[model samples]
Target: MSLPPAFLDELRARVPLAPVVGRRVKLTRAGREWKGCCPFHNEKTPSFYVNDDKGFYHCFGCGAHGDVIRFLTEQEGMGFIDAVKQLAAQAGMEVPSESPEARARAEVADTLQSLAGRAAEWFQAQLRSTAGAEARAYLDRRGVSATMIKDFALGFSPESRTALKTALKDAGEDKLVEAGLLGRSDDGQTYDRFRGRLMFPIRDRRGRVVGFGGRALGDIQPKYLNSADGPLFDKGRLLYNLDRAGPVAHKSGRLVVVEGYMDVIGVAQAGIAELVAPLGTAMTETQLALAWRQVDEPILCFDGDGAGQRAALRACLRALPLLAPGKSLRIATLPPGEDPDDLVKRGGAPAFEVVLDAALPLSEYLWRSETEGQDTATPERRAAVRQRLKAHADAIADPSVRALYAADFNARFDALYFARPERPPRQAFVRGARYVAPLAGASPALRSRGPGARTASGEVTALLAGLLTHPGLADRHGEALAALPMSDPRQAELRDAILSALALSPDLESDALNADLVRRGVGGLADATLKSNRLRFSFTRRDAAADATARDFGMMVDTIAARTRIELELETATARFRSSLEDSDFERQQALLAERVEIDSAMMRLAESLRDD
Candidate 1:
């Protein structure tokens, strides 16, 4: 829903700039404006400047500059609206809906959020009662404190399904359904989905409740039930503790990603506030991108199980490609069979600190742990291990990261061979394939997108992303993103999103753009604008930005051309099938037709979007 511009203006008027920027970046007096090392980029010199008086900022070093809204939006990697909403909330002023249409839509979202909030309160209150004793004991066993429970707003759902159903219905059920706390019967009767469980409200970086994660309090069937996807909660898109960890993440330039809520709560309680967790699923691109916003490096602290190893490997693969100049990742392994929850129980909070210190960089862990002398007596085993590790390295998209792994891997393998009693010839009579074969259905032409688009997209994405990541970016133009046409659906949708957020949250703060995109359903937009968006220069210091507009232009052109080619091929396939209705041929034609339909939809959206002036 779009919001009126006036709301943003009012929001900015309400909150002072000092508290917002001061939290992440250290600001000292510098003439009339405040100065700090640019948080958007690592810098030795303090070049970023902010003037609280006018609410405008500029960076002499990187050329990023904008209003407080832009800074918050850019720095926290939040879109415009989320930044504003976060800031406005801090000011204790509600972002009132603007037009009736916008207001109505906002109301639906707000109602669900409000319901979740009320349900959270009800759960917390019950925990204080006798019914919550076992839940409290469970927490105590896990080492979570009353203050920790209170801070996280932990609650228990009664064994009676209708208990929660009744509480929400009297207050409101439609919103509860919207928030994903309750479900409906086919006839439209509402019922609580999370019964007889301990509730953990999932909050965005700004601390508004988006959804919940529930653990069975006793021997409840299924053992664990979570809030399904709703207007607000997407299980794949959120981390468990983004709200509480963001500030610490930003300041420390690090993130500790554990596997569960109690793990996060335990670490936070133990004194490490910069901890987050993936909810049950493997860590996702959405979760990582959100973490990327707050810190330069992320420490994947999962259990030391094969499953956890697999999860860590998957995360490392996703992260390697993105961990170019500004980003890095470390893997922290717990003792066998112990998780963060267990470690916190056994050694208390300080145990986590010790584990964190022992964490290994990606190359170190993979080479040292996974490839260490696993019965290399067989050539097949050596080759198999090498193949597996090679596959892991190949997933790294960045040129530098891949090179690092290649060098480190070769060295480690060479060392292992020298230590062996018998070794295969260093080189094969015929060498094996150097790279993994492309997956079936992989686009043959995806690699052909022009470099210019990549460069432009990269710059715009980096600058904008940097701004969204660092509050100090509001004061520096080096981190500022060149605005795109607001009418272009892809860009326009984001613009509308940011604008609406501004109207609601005038101050413009976001923990990460990834979260904001999920909130607005534009993760695709965020990724497209960032991945191929490239630059030849260092993002921290560069020559004139490679024309930022070229990326959008190239993207539209590429999309149109690709669509046209597919359309023609599809038409040919369809015509061949129509000419003769042979069963086998007909099936092939249908397949082509289905692919064409998907291609056509994308073309239409792109075409219509480009048509938007």
Candidate 2:
């Protein structure tokens, strides 16, 4: 819900900007005002001046100037509504209701957050009390000290089924209901979500207590489980130990992503505080991107289980395409069935550290470890492995890493390792060795255009791109382009992106054009189309007549336009289908399914028609 504007305005009134921003920068007294360096932008000298009289701040360096609301939005990376909420809290002032909807929603979040805060305190309090004896003992047996448990906000949920439910009822049961802490029966009886479990408050990197991970206290059916889906937590996205380990990982220059939560806790407790874990899901692309942002390299320590070995292989595979120039990925394989946590317990944290230090680069590990003894003694087997190695090496996104790995791989596998006992030279495969899951159920569509098909489509996209990029072309070409049909959906999207870009801005630059297209959901379409335009430009820029360029553009445009018309026709056929048809029954259903399949297949082809820039 949108916030009441007045609440935000009043929030701006409280916690006067001069004082709030003054503490962050070196401010000089300048006639009822102050001046300091612009925190938003880099500046050699102080150009950020503040007027205490008006509660306004301005940076002459980058033209970033605003009041407290703007300050929080720019500096703290907070939304306007959240910043106002924060500023209101700073002022010790309750934000008066602005709108009915905003009031109701904010009240819900506020009440739940308050209830969670109180509940967290109670749980931590229990860890010190006698009721928490078992939980404390469990941690002690696991070698987690009081200091580490306290630091991680670790605590116990008493064996009673409703200890937290009763506590939250007294504090506020409405909050319990809202936060999903209580599960209601048909008769209105409520029970706790977690029972007889040890609690670990799951936190976001910013240290907000979003949810919880609960462990079964004793031998039970399921072991070491986390809370089910809640309003605040999505297990797939959350990383255990991120709050405690992120900074240390960032500071220490490497992150260790172990497979389990206790392993994270164990490693951190052992003073190897740079450990993190995914919330029991496979390491996803989103997690990789988030991990990449915090550190230069990540060492994945999968357990010694078979599943762990597969996970380690997957980590190497996924990291292949995402390997950046400076970033590195290393895989640390633990001994059979032992994880970092178990290893740390048996051999101490130093043992885990030694394993991490011995971690090999992902490419090296995947190529060498898997193929070290797999019939490599035979020439044919070595040839197959070497070919696969070359393919994986080619998949590395960083050129330098690829080059260095290639050199090292060649040095390791000399002529002594060969096929048919003949000396062989390294060769580049047409398509590299990395395996990409096909788009759903189908194989990769042909990316290369059919003979003479490329030039016409290329010209058309370039023309549309120019018309969209420069408004002047639309005036010249608007009338000559309406006769033919484009049979591709990607062509339609490209045309739409061009038209949309033209409507928003007459003289479109690259960034603005691409951003507008992305906002419209044909995100990368504009970039690909523009790259095609660049190709056409480079090819024909010298001594090509304006008419020739336009003619070539016209050719490509007609081809794409034809594809787009066909796309709309196919879309119309599938849009009118029903799950339960009244007319022809099975025959209609089968026909509808076929039409839908064709449309989908056609769209896939259309997308593939536009290759990588």
Candidate 3:
């Protein structure tokens, strides 16, 4: 049974070809297509190739060729009807029944599509005629060449309300309205929808004219008007120039999304063919998915104005939930007061190329959007920034990508606000000088003196030694490490050095980290710290099991951090009790003292555990 061409087209658009072929053939991405060994014939090297943009597969080895349906019919040995049925099920489309009503509906769709093509032809003819003088002048003034006019099938609608209506009178007013070529008023008066405007034909993925976008010429309120949603057109789901841009984008490994048709036309005229535009709206999720099907990261080259930036942000937010590994967007901002068309027209494609080259990754753009020009001086303000960043990170649906984003944002936050303060130069350390570890079971009287009684410097040394032994620990517990208070200037310097190295390369091995630290003049500091403390703490020893060392190192860090917090609280409480001789202040001080004692006891237990391990 024959099916409507439009139905077949929709089916093809809905079902991606790569995944269909991939179920049978192990395919690897090769530029714009998937390549695999030919299943038609035994071959060691991959000769079969699938191009999703073009929706076809070919094999040089066996001289095999077919589309998705044909691939199943021939390769999998299924009948044509069975293949269509299975694909229709996958696409969630029911097969049109071979009934009179279905046939009539199909006929009407075909007729409307035919009328749209005819309307385009009439518009093109009118563009070259006297009726289109104003539109022609407008195009010429905008630097649109005649060749571009012909190539893009650009035309002009006459100023007469009934111009298109009269030209396509035989198509019937009802059919014309359904095709979005004519609009019917509430009083039942029918008229042309687009009048006296430079016309841009909007095509489907198969390059069939489905709708039109018109730029008003003379003092029109809505400067740009698109064809009303009809049987064939849904602006939110369709992108202008996608049909032509897909193949070009695939071949070049680049797809640029501009603001409007003029920007797309201007950029394409400059010989950059891989470009598209949303249909008179901020980019919708469907449009983004369509672009992603062609390229991994499509560049959004919006105008540099506030509106354009807002559009970019909306697109970014829309895409966050849909983002996956290797699937994302890059955003390019044109100069202030310039759109892509203006930029390209001014400095040629090179200027536009520079903007594209300098395009920021979506993550960077998001970061700047939240943090740029915002005051992060106070802890509360910085925390607010962090909460906003976390909200964005959590918007990502994929767990792995979400985790990575959260980690990256947290790292940036710490780097921006909690960066280790500079410390004095390390005092000269004599080689082979053994520094004793603080006693694990100190008396309550000594412990009351806070971390001072615990030899805070020795604990800091051990922590640094553990980090030097296993640089990976720094990556795992960066925030914790950054929060650790180091009184010794030498240890603080070494800790900062480690963090800086990890910031550069989070996966840096122990040897590379040590070498980097050594080059930064912290090698002796690390050596001195390790030699003095490694003998006391087993986790600092390079021979210890990594998992066990990490656990012990984390416990040691928590214990030290807790002790530091209690010491600060104790100091604050002491001042408050002295300043206000009130009972509440005294109770607060006493409570803090009790908490400090507990923390000190925990630190002692941690130290004893590390020594025993």
Candidate 4:
């Protein structure tokens, strides 16, 4: 039985090519495509490739090529119908039977799509006619070039209600109403849904016109209006410009989501092709999924205004439950009272590029949204913030990703709110009676025991050792460990090797990690660091309890990071004091000295705590 073309297309989109082909061929990722040895013909070197983005596989060795359907039929020797049935089942789609009713429904859907296309053409003709002067002038005011207008299929609907109906009269009234071109009132009176408005044709991924979005040229309520849901279009399931943006986003590994049609068009006019927009609504899960399929983290560019910020937060909340490893969003805030169209129009793509460059990852954006402008000065307020952050992190469906997010949020919270030790009263300074240098008179034992005694390199070595003993810590502290400053090339190489191994196999145990590191030529470094007497912390012990090891490892990382910051501050203050010799510089140096002392005491306390455990 013949299936609808739409159903077949949906099947291709739903079932990724990699897994389907991987069942028979061992595919390894090569750029955006997967490479595997051709199952059809055997050779030493691999030449078969499958591209999920294009939903096809090709073998350069034997010149074999086809999509998932063809692969199943040719490789598995399944009949065409059986191959399609298997894919349909895999995609969780019911195969359309070739019954008269189903055929009629399919025919109606096709007719509606065709009518929508013809309606688009009619609107374009109207935009070029004398009745479209207002729409043309509005486009000019928005700095939309003629080329852009044509490229995006920008058009207009005349002010009269019957203009489109009369233009496409042969399509009949019922089909026009069904296609969302005309609205029927309770009294059974039908009228044009869009009048005196700028028109945007919303197309499916196949570039078929599915619906229309209208921006009122004059003073109209609900400045933008989208077609009501119909068989051909569901706004929640579609993103504007997705048909064009998918291939570009896949190629560049960058996808951008804006707020509306003009934003997409404006950004595209600036030479960026990987852009899409929700049809006048907050992004839906399906829409976000579509964007994720194109790129792992699509940038959601929103205006910096309060409404824009709220929209962005809503999108974040919607996305939290759907986030998985490497699948999340980055948010870029436009200048207040500005959008992509405004920014691009005023300063071109370079201006938009700056915003994109400063985009915040999902975790950072969530933290800021929950804490920015809120009072976290008190313990109660801070506890509330923690609870809220935990709740959001808990929404993530993937356990490993959720745990990592929670750990990351905890680290950020400590850094921002709890890192600073309470300052001593100003009276304790005695107006800087005499500024003593930091740690100058400490005993050698105290100096050697303090976090300040270890260079950044030594601390990194100890951190790596702890990680090697407890490779599971990589799930929670991988990002932090990766960010640790390493000056020694050998230490950095070992650090990268450890992280790479963990990434390749997140559940790798200590022995497996050691083996993998050795394979990468850094096993000696790992062994030497572990065997050295320097890392005496309990967390580095093989027999340490999991909870204690994780806690102690976190403390070690925090202490090292704090020491690095204070050392940098001390160096800057010393440089300024040497140059100016001013009392303020001296006072600043002394204050930093106090902070440094406090950090050393904290480190000693941590050592004591770990030893007690």
Q: lDDT scores for all predictions?
A: 0.66, 0.64, 0.80, 0.81
> For each candidate, C-alpha RMSD in Å?
15.5, 15.1, 16.2, 13.8
* Candidate 4 structure quality by residue, lDDT tens digits, 1-613: 7778898899999999899889877889899889988876767798778888878787655556678998775665344666797899888887887897877887898799999999999889989999999999999888888999999898899888788888888988888998999999999888899999999999877577999999988789889999989888899999999878875675467899989899888888898888899998998999998788677899999777999889999999999999997899999998999989999889999999999999999999999888899987789999999899989989999865775676567667766886656665223223437654432222233334332334455556677888898899888887777666665768867777776666545679999899988887777888888877374777778887999889888878878778766765665555444433468767877898789889988877876776633
The TM-score values for the models, in the order shown, are 0.61, 0.51, 0.58, 0.58
Model number with the top TM-score: 1
Write down the worst ten-residue block by lDDT for model 1: 434-443
Error (Å) of candidate 4 at residue 30 is 18
lDDT of 1 by residue, 1-613 (tens): 4667788777766776656777667888987778888776678998777777767666655555677777775566565678877787788877776677887877777777777778789888877888888888888877678899888999988777688777767667766677787889999887888877888988876677878888997786767677879777788888888877776676567789988888788777767788898988888887888887776678999988888878887887777666675577789989989888778667877888899899898778777656765777888888888777777677778754564465456556655665556645333122153221122211233233321122223334444433333323333331112333222346546434443333323455554435666676776765665454443222222222334333334444355445444544443333333333346544554565466568657755654553323
lDDT, candidate 3, equals 0.80
Indicate the residue-level lDDT of 203 in model 3: 84
Superior by lDDT: candidate 2 or candidate 4 = 4
- Runs in model 3 lying further than 4 Å from the true structure: 1-106, 422-613
Span of ten consecutive residues with least summed lDDT in model 4: 438-447
Per residue, candidate 3 scores C-alpha lDDT tens digits across 323-373 of 998999999988899998999889999999999999999999999999999
Model 2 C-alpha lDDT versus the unseen true structure: 0.64
Question: What lDDT is obtained when candidate 4 is compared to the true structure?
Answer: 0.81
- Give the range where candidate 3 is weakest over 10 consecutive residues by summed lDDT: 434-443
Ten-residue segment with the worst summed lDDT in candidate 2? 437-446
| Candidate 1 positional error at 326, Å | 3.4
TM-score of 2: 0.51
